[model samples]
Target: MNFGFLKIAAAIPEIEVADCRHNTAEMEKLLREACQRGVSVIAFPELSVTGYTCGDLFGQPVLLAEAEKTFGELMERTADCPAVAVAGLPVAVDGRLYNAAAVFCRGKLLGIVPKTYLPNYNEYYEVRWFASGDELKTDTVTLCGQTVPVSSKLLFRSGEVCLGIELCEDLWVPVPPSSLQAVHGANVLVNLSASNEMVGKHDYLRDLVRQQSARTVSAYLYASAGCGESTTDVVFAGNGLIAENGVLLEEAERFVPGSRLVCCDIDIERLAALRRKTNTFAYAGPSPAFRSVAFDLPAYGRSYPLLRHYNPTPFVPSDDDGKHRRCEEIFDIQCTGLARRIRHTGARTAVIGISGGLDSTLALLVAVRTFDLLGLPRKRILGVTMPGFGTTDRTYDNAMGLMRALGVEIRETDIRAACLQHFADIGLEADDRSVTYENAQARERTQILMDLANRSGGMVVGTGDLSELALGWATYNGDHMSMYGVNCSIPKTLVRHLVGWIAATHADEATRPWLLDIIDTPISPELLPADERGDIAQRTEDLVGPYELHDFFLYHFMRFGVPPDKLFFIARHAFGERYAPETIKKWLVVFLRRFFAQQFKRSAMPDGPKVGSVSLSPRGDWRMPSDASAALWIAQAEAIRTDEP
Candidate 1:
């Protein structure tokens, strides 16, 4: 396995009823093909050695003896193969017949897992032929001249991948055997099925596989019988699927003419990480002991193709409808959260600083929605425009126009003179234009907003978003601190999208123009003086790499705890030709250093409802050391940098 990914396949080979020799030969061919393609583990349909529709032939001594001989040949022929193969057949154990999947790896029989649940309903009568595993009197059984462990609690292990087996109807029951296997330590579940084709069954079966994999936090490989089976009474569609954590990685098209195989790489590390995070998934004490059969296989190399598609923008949905709906729901969450804060604090006015930037624009919109939800007059919402030294005509005009359009009580609090005076008082030259100068302006504007809110019996609504908080872009005790932050959990990339969405769908015509203009403007804090033409001089992205890259880094780093090397690999693949490896490596280094160095800023962040699964709320989702070291993470990224941008 490479980076916790195990290459697995679901194989469906053509078979004939009661023809054990032909069925076994077909399975052997598929096994060789799958193994050649680097499949570490492969699964075949239930009763594949002897067709599932064998009827009373299953009880005939001639059919049983032939199946035993064919199965032995299959095991011997595949003994030297590196891949682990699971093929289903009927095994006679101490006078009782059991439907079992015999796992083979490295020239030896690993174990046999029997079907737990048998269906006895319409168009099915498994109980008439085979006995469920629950009736087993002993844990060990003699099959094909080899004594092997046989039970429902058999877990096969090859290196890091733990394998679990379940039969067809076992998954259709209320509680699948795979569920307990997962909780007991199975990270990969395989199902051998012979489900008959019917109307609308594929959709339901697909959902079952997806949901079971997700609920168990394991990778599921399902292989079912195909069209070559006796179609006298029913047709087998040969549905094959490979799913991981509710996502279908790969699946075979139904009703294919020949034998089929679907393969994909399953991220076992991701599953283990999620299980570790979810408290309820912790294994309960004293479960049935698994008889593990250890086998050896070389680790997968980097050349193995990753069949999974990693979304470039994990935060933003690709579809327009999903994006619009997301914006609406996030807007409601912000408004409802702020409204509750206002009602609980008994504040009369909603105070916010509108800078004509994406973060501030989103905050102001939420403030307006909150007042409207509370049935308060629009004038009661105070929108403050605190123009600093770097303020430009375009942003200032847009800010003033938005205020006028919204009809909120707008106040102009220019901090140019006040900041200069404070800079001199602190013995710092305004011409220096360093962090001191920039922070002086930010602190001055924050002071104006806070004092005004106090005087008006209102609260200072913060505009700093999750992206800024992640990089510590906001000045400490200045834009970083607030009474309550409405945009705290939203990333800068999403902040822009949310603003544009509101302009297009929600904002009135008069206010829409200003909102669009704000979205078009460059993202900046206006901390420095403008250029000769009076345009923005200090773009945030120019200083700290693109927000798009930073947001991508933040999501994978925080949400999945992906290591630096693996994250770099995924970024190179996701960005494709858009960004070179060196560029991603550079920003990845910066993101890690900033994320660790800026934990002090996030340690005291204000209350904000988490709008997404990934959040940096110190009191809720994330809690990190203020002095955590970024040396190791940075060194790893720097090693991969070779001037290839």
Candidate 2:
């Protein structure tokens, strides 16, 4: 399936000043090339037919006549191409000339959008030759023996993609015509621009396109004038940009010597989903003055190669600089939240359970930072290591080492004896490692921590991460219950990175190695005993599937509300090299089942600061009924064929 993706392009063609014939030929060449590559809509630079630098020649009847004839001929030549084309030219209506972009498909003129804003400044004198399209007296313009709708409020629609056009200086104005077009149901906005290159103008121009796409929640395609334009006063770099919902998908290298095009696929469905989720985008109804032009394109029912990149680890940054920055920011948020809670409650001590696993290590680090921020002694933060039936010596030693290095008061309490007593009281066999047997140990550890906190007039800091909460991987009222959850919204994949950041940036020489070793250790609750080699026997990933997959599923599902089949499709693309299709499908099923079945846990989850877009805080970002059925979601997931290409 095409999966709601629409391929769009920004074509920058070589041209000569006032050479309509040569310019039209060059545009046709790039048009056909882009169509062959499956582009559904392609846009060209402003006034491309007669060149933006034609200057006073724009008023010459000969140049205007030739531009119209040549553009008509160009359309006729590319009539067989499937892609809809938007090209800039000067249009004459009611005895006045206006800068405009013509939209056409299959040799037919769809509409003409006049430039609403004309620049009359230091480097520009557009008012000398052409009138602002906003002042046009007629709604229809006759060009090349054809009459078409002419207005600044026209939108062209083809299947799921809707096109809106603005020319040259329109985008630089306070209120671009494309903004209204978007609010009137335009999903794709195209700007045919002839902006000249200035030292710092390129970066500012990119920012404009990016921010506009984000604000309108639409796909934006920008095509600018190239090197062939008149260089008498300024240079045109022929910049082409394609952005979707705040992200710049493709940016052509500026100042290239030849004709080139930048193309990428935009997720139309995702944009629609975001618009619907945000709700405010639909509040303003379509204006009565706006008109919709309908056209046809090739069917997008079949699958094609995707040009977009899907980061497999969405929660974790893919670059080192971004990763370090994100880790530091998240650490600050965690520490800030913890510090506020300690101050508000006036708790004399900050009590935390220090397991050698990733979550507890991060929670401990945040507590230490919070204590330092509050100017409280490290000894006031109690670090308890409760060794249960499954705790190994490696985790125990690392826990002790980290606590001591951080100058926190370390306390060790063996929970195996209490768990065995509880099993005896319940008349259950200690050898049976079932849920009851495992949960007894967890409850015992929590009880000890709570008693310790009560004795010291402190609060127990929870260490369960977001991934565990999503999968319902914690024992309810056991590790899942706490006064405040510092690591509650942090996902497992990010927890490791935060700890690693501390080890690299903040850890002392004595503490860095212990933090690094804790990161290297496998993630587990250590609820079950060690194996024959005294290593962890119950690997969490082996039982509940990889934390990486679960985190990926949670981020997309919650953030974008992507349904199961599409999620599977993108997951396959994102991790195709690292994981087999069957493996991803298997764990996807597990993630869905657990996520739905575990809403009860999240419904009663402890209060924690929401640090990201995807959070399960019942009182804040997410709120779902505890008994919501997963039947429909599971059915959709199960219907996907792993063998399909």
Candidate 3:
């Protein structure tokens, strides 16, 4: 019941028709096993105690008696365990039977949620034996030995988790009960189902659960009856699923020999954050007042074994096929945006600075692709290489080679002399190397590009990536300012992959070696003087931090709006083996300070297409004050100092 995490389980227990005693025993066995695995909330299939295919046997007095006795015993079994369990059964009240899910915690019955919609067409006739929840005479019904609230408006709460119960057919309705429950403050929804196996039915069922969870922005747990039921009319293949916000976290294998139990850890904090960010989710309308049942469940502390998979590189997909599709889509967006700018502005040439780095290389590729799409001459693309004091032979030669191989109009300008002259004019010594010395070179190169674009009747394509913008790594009014920034929304880590994809798929044989070599080269701004060996002397990572860590921090903080404490916790789990906790904590502090202090830079950023969920474009996605204080974020991060490495 922690705010950040809730461990849930979906169980399918083997059952015999009209054999409530044996079914209850089997359910207790599975429940104990799941609880031992640290599952806090467990949901079983619909009519799991009496079987959904009991048919006319559902009305037999003996079967009804056995179900009531078994339900009481099941409630007692949960008394010794801290886990809350939801099991389906038939509840009789006022001369009519209702299909309901009995929810209990510890030794008390929480409530009974009656099935609102019953399927009565085509091999299904629940209306023949049971009644829908719409015709309730009273709000309370006798369950086990105590009277509990029985209505469609009952919500159960245990600590920070709020749960709403729905049956099988309820999810397939035009508007689901879970939707209203979510709007009324339910963060978790559990469904008890007995859907029969059929061709293509599983896909629709899966999509239904996913779409419902996504629409409500809640965590959904679904459990269905399995092979132990009477398969007289339809085969019951036990299927269990656990999903959070449209993403399937865990699902059990269908048509297995025995009862299946699948468990996952859902992030309740993320759900809450999403709801708070969405205006419609908060201001939809006034919902009906419902009964709230509070129960006690053991609290999971700050740390626990994670059942959900945390991708180390959330910005980059792991699958090759997904990566391919993503790369294609991103390229399409970049090229399309550049083409529109070109056509709208009536520019004939595209001038891009070629530094032989990943960002510049990607920018150049996009420029060439846009020209091709617009049916412009390749020679109309002006590729400029301004070799400065720190430019090494590896990068310089790669730049020249790529420009020649791409068959673009190439231009070269040496800015060392211009920067030296500027330093002399400013009364600064060349021997005294400092920030001024570095920035002078960057500004000189940008001046050359701007001038070249003006002389050639073209536009300057910016190469600084989203990571640089986020950390304020770019020189203001130097490389950071441009007419158009193609890589403005791409992070540094993903820029490498995009370049690799182009080299492997788009580059010719003559250009492939140069592209690969550029990728193999180290990332540097090349602002200072080169080493005696004519190699790159200043590494970006050594000065700031790892781009991987920075990208991870940026994604979770901005995309999910996760606070610093939870972000640090998740990062520790995602990169514990690769990076030390102290190292991560240190850079996390740097990231927070820089992100807050550099809003003014992002505020004036050039227009670029957003290709992913996270974008810091001021006019599009993120808007913040330039002078906002980082005191709260910094204080939260500083409090997390630990002795562990």
In candidate 3, which residue ranges exceed 4 Å CA deviation? Answer: 1-3, 283-289
Report the C-alpha displacement of residue 79, candidate 1, in angstroms: 3.0
Query: Each model's TM-score?
Result: 0.94, 0.97, 0.96
What is candidate 3's lDDT per residue for 1-645, written digit by digit as tens? 443788899999878888899888888888888778778899999999999999999879999999999889887876887788999999998889999999987778989999999999998999999999878889998878899899989999865689999999999999898999998889899999999999999999999999899999999999999978877778988989999899888999999977668999999889988888877884556666788999777665644577888777888888899999999999999999999999999887888889989899999999988888889989999999999988999999999999999999999999887887899999998597899888888888889889888888889988999899899898888898888899999999999999999999999999899999999999999987789999999989998899999999999898788888777778887886798888888999999999999998899888888889889899988999999999999999999856632
Q: Write the per-residue lDDT of candidate 2 for residues 411-464, one digit (tens) a residue.
A: 889887787888999999858889999888888888989999999999999999
Model 2, runs deviating above 4 Å:
283-288
TM-score of 3: 0.96
RMSD in Å for all candidates:
2.3, 1.6, 1.9
By TM-score rank, best first, the candidates go: 2, 3, 1
Q: Positional deviation of 507 in candidate 2, in angstroms?
A: 1.7
For candidate 3, what's the RMSD?
1.9
lDDT of each: 0.88, 0.89, 0.89
Model 1, C-alpha of 309: deviation from truth (Å): 1.1
Better of 1 and 3 by TM-score: 3
